[model samples]
Target: MDASHHPCGGIPSRLPGGGGAPRPDARGWPKGCPSTVARERIRVPEATRRVKPAAACIVRHNYYPDTHVRRDAEALVEAGYDVSVVSLRRPGQAAREALCGVNVYRLPMQHRRGSSLRYAWEYTLFLFLAFLTVTALHVKKRFRVVEVDNMPDILVLSALVPRLLGVRVILYVFDNMPELLAYLRGWSARHPVVRFLAFLERLSARFADRVIVTQEMPRRAMASRGVPRHKIAVVLNSADETAFVPSAAPDAGRRDVFQIVSHGVILERYGVQVLIEALPSIAAQVPGVEVQVFGEGEYRRALEEQARRNGTTQLVSFRGFAPFDELIATLARADVGYVGMLNDLVLPNKLMEYVALGVPVTASRWPTFLHYFPDEAVAYFRPGDPEDLAAAIVRMHRNPASSRARARRAKELYQDYRWSVQREVYLGVYSELLNGVVGASAMGSRVGAAPYQRS
Candidate 1:
């Protein structure tokens, strides 16, 4: 259950091109060019002029339209601050686009960099390009807040630039970066890059004006690492109720069979195999339970193999990730939402999204769940315990009324965890940064660089 100790599937060390490992780039640096101007060319609008440049910039190397980043950045924009996101653009998306009135700039990524060295070089180049974009955007318009979210804690170092420039740095810690690295190496020897990243994480946490984590576990972990509780705010992932709300019920014919659905990246930590192996037992007990997995990842082939091995290939189907609207449609059709994450340090955000859609969620039990979900709210089975999971699935199938009630309750509870709440928390953070109430020196008064703690 402790994935921090699990060995990760081996990944190549040198990406193609032998470029340095990718790190988040400096704000306002030009994309793909070193000598180009780093600042923005556009003039600041009068409406935005009243609002001081945010010391914080939401930074992530991950793609845009990522639910949380987009939602948070949009909320920040509504609160009247300059927000720019630095991330990789998929081949199809344009280099720049304004969505929900927020400026989103994407840099080209070299996915072809097959080796780790090439990947690192490409990513570093990405960072530099992103920095140029950020600089141009910021100089053209002042920004005061620099927020770093997503994985690869090396990006945390980006906070240093803003801090040096007198801007407040906020760490929106989502996943634990070092734990992820160790997992990749099968929890074996630590790599120098991982060590350096760990070092950077410590420095960033120590100096960050505020620390925002997704769940209580990370907050406590950060606290143990010396981040004060006051400086840390627990910002759990919230569902976009407006986008995910259930639509009118489909016809009884369309709902003739019970549909169980799961989505997102299909990776080891998602524990899809356990669920597949449990299907035979579930089928023996429940007459019409069908499990559909949405999304693809490293573990997909293994999952297919398990389904074939278990002879439940007929009941289990692999449906890859769908567009947002289509995903909502699938959620609407799904009677039970299967929520899984290899019992590990991080909680699965999809579970929250599932609950928001008002679907009864059945998940692999993890310690992280205790922090946010009530025992009654979810039907939890031991991590990787096929029998327990099958039994839980059977229990839900046999008790449709109870399942329906639970789903209704989950939807009602979803309001408390909605972005409406997160918006206010972010606004408070921005206000704190703008007032300069918290300074870099104050941050230094906190603990020094400390290694990330494992469960």
Candidate 2:
């Protein structure tokens, strides 16, 4: 297969070609990096891979290298499934390429989260384009499964043809879109836009043969809307113990300055703004305190402006993204790793990353976070409260021995959520869906040929 250009959209392909190791760009946040997991996150040679491939088509609106979607694709491939990712294309990325062992096709469209109408256009446009692309790919070689990772939520509807051919459709929802938009935009649950989003979300769940949510809250939320319990899978965003090999570290006593680290897209709902608010208070209590933020987003520029406005730019630094190994090493060396998001329902990916690296952690205190992370495992602070977060940081600073002990406890608890342990659940769900176990009325919701038979 000549996987070099987009299958559709006559927009004459443009490419800066392959992705080299990340170097500082003008904005300084690894600007041109093509994907998050650049074969650095997964590796399985063709000679060693299983001969029989359970063919799969995975779709997402995000970049091809999104950690969660990439991890899921890697898991499917590891379980003898041939996986192909349909993802968005940025400036520097090629329209098509292979990462690790999974084939990827990038569509010629990109959308940033914004207004209600803007989201509507972007989602509808991508849905039409992706539907055409997947249909064409399906004719080339049949796929037994189509998995859609959500943001718009209803992208699974793009698998119309395959679903007609009896291919199972799985809705792999990473975050609850309605709740996320509500929090980000400060919209009430009963608001028109929020209710509309909730309706779309329900449509997406109803359209899928199986729904995979990152945490228990979403699963229960879906169940409350009448989706069967068995149809929903609770797959937390846990670290893979085998994949992350921690680097050697020095004693905390040797460091004179108190350093804190946070990474990933600097979104407003993540409450990184709260981190900015806490900096002055933290500096007052501990003069040498510095917060190193890696990764970039529109919110990052806002954060930098906020730091300048507060005259605390010296206390915060935007270090930008590094190669996977170096990024982990940076966190492993930090005194404290923080997950300061405003929402409590979703699991913080960075929290798991912090736990895996055995880094002393301080995170927003919420029922959802505490459900998975116990009090002894991680220090907590009130979400959206700068004073509380600063106090949490100071507590960790004053008692290094206690925090280290908590990190050790967290690491032991994280063992169960590893990809090694969790992959089986994903496979089991796919296996059931493939066997024609329509836990819900997927066929009726689908606009395809009558019902499919048991394979």
Candidate 3:
């Protein structure tokens, strides 16, 4: 089913922070001073260099180049935690190697994504192997915390042994299973599968000592399921300034045709196809318009076919994937950065990258986005409406001054949501967890009994 027809709750239409907003400083930044140092070299305490990390992280995928994970792990290391990462072994990744002061461990396993049964088999095997790997590492040298980056939400179970041994378990929810499945399978909230997955999601959150959500909607989802508000942390996936700072030559020169670009995972619900559909219309108005896609996924071919059907085959260009530096260079030269995602639940990294580089953003005006970005910083368009997106493109093309103003505000807004702010928020959570500052009842409630057993 096309995402437009998915039976789900309608996103609120009002803009956030307009009526009454959270104090920007109170949100995460310091009360008086701006913190932008994560862009520079992170300082590691020589005194604590040899000390054990505050936590050990187990990510299902290889972490050598995962931007956010790498950024946060480095922050933790610099903050006196001797972090270790257990990740998948890619084609040539060493089974054991250290990167950026974090000791790395690899388990040999391949992943598949086509079928439900295949996913279950792979996740189950990973849950089992990751359990053994983390347990052994803990026995060798204990860590105070065990962090799991969830895809298979229940993989937090891998940290059971350590939690039983007095370590804290943190489940970082990159994506929630319920909404993901409902959106992906085009199932209604009332669907049995959706309900079952929601049950499992709550179950996993209940088992973890603390839950971290990448965005506010997921936090609400957990809280609605009876998880205490305090037990969950909202760690916005802010961009690291080192990698996403404003381009040295942000406003170089636009080609005869305007460039609209998006770089990230190619997913159906993300509404990139809508962007492609809008291209033909955009070209009608702004004859100088091109769409540059710089990512790959199962959805790529479908988008290409759609472009062909829309007669935008020549207008939409897929550059596949490239290193971050190359992406930055390409984006620096773009006239407008595109983020047309329809999912109210997702906030793609492309949005942050585009805004940081002072590129005018044209995104689906989902309410959750309003919470983070004011309407002025990002041009609003109806989700799943290609014409609306085309209208936005035309507006930017016609009134470059207004577009430039929005881009300037976007760059200014980016500072408040930088990695420095989130790094501090993350460390604060760990500090509370490590210092026994969180309410004891909440900590004890989850750790009393973890759901999995590896023995």
User: Which candidate tops lDDT?
Assistant: 2
**TM-score of each model, in listed order:** 0.78, 0.83, 0.84
Candidate 1, poorest ten consecutive residues by summed lDDT? 6-15
Would you list the clashing residue pairs of candidate 3?
53-82, 257-288, 258-288
lDDT for 313 in candidate 1 is 89
Point out the worst 10-residue segment of candidate 2 by lDDT: 1-10
* Model 3 bad stretches (over 4 Å): 1-55, 61-63, 251-255, 439-455
| Per-prediction CA RMSD (Å) | 10.0, 7.6, 10.2
Question: lDDT tens digits, residues 1-455, model 1?
Answer: 12111112111111112122221121111123221121233344566554444423677766665435656776665554556777666655667665554567767762342565765675566567756666666566555677876454555565555566776677777766666667655664257866665676666777777777776777776676666777877665665566566555533365347788877667777777888888888888777778878765668999898888889889998976444455676777777888767746666667777887777888878877755676667888888888998888888888877877877777676676776565565566666566555533222222111111112
lDDT of 3 by residue, 1-455 (tens): 21111112111011112112212211122221122354245454465445444555645443332435556776666665667777655555567765555677867865545578777887788789889989999987676788887777788898889988888888888777788888877889989988988888888888887888887888888899888888888777866666565445755564586889887667677788888877777887887688888766668899989988879888888987555456777788788888777778767777877877778888899987777888888888998998888898899889988988998888887776777666667776667676666744222232121111112
Ranking 1 against 2 by lDDT, winner: 2
lDDT of each: 0.63, 0.72, 0.70
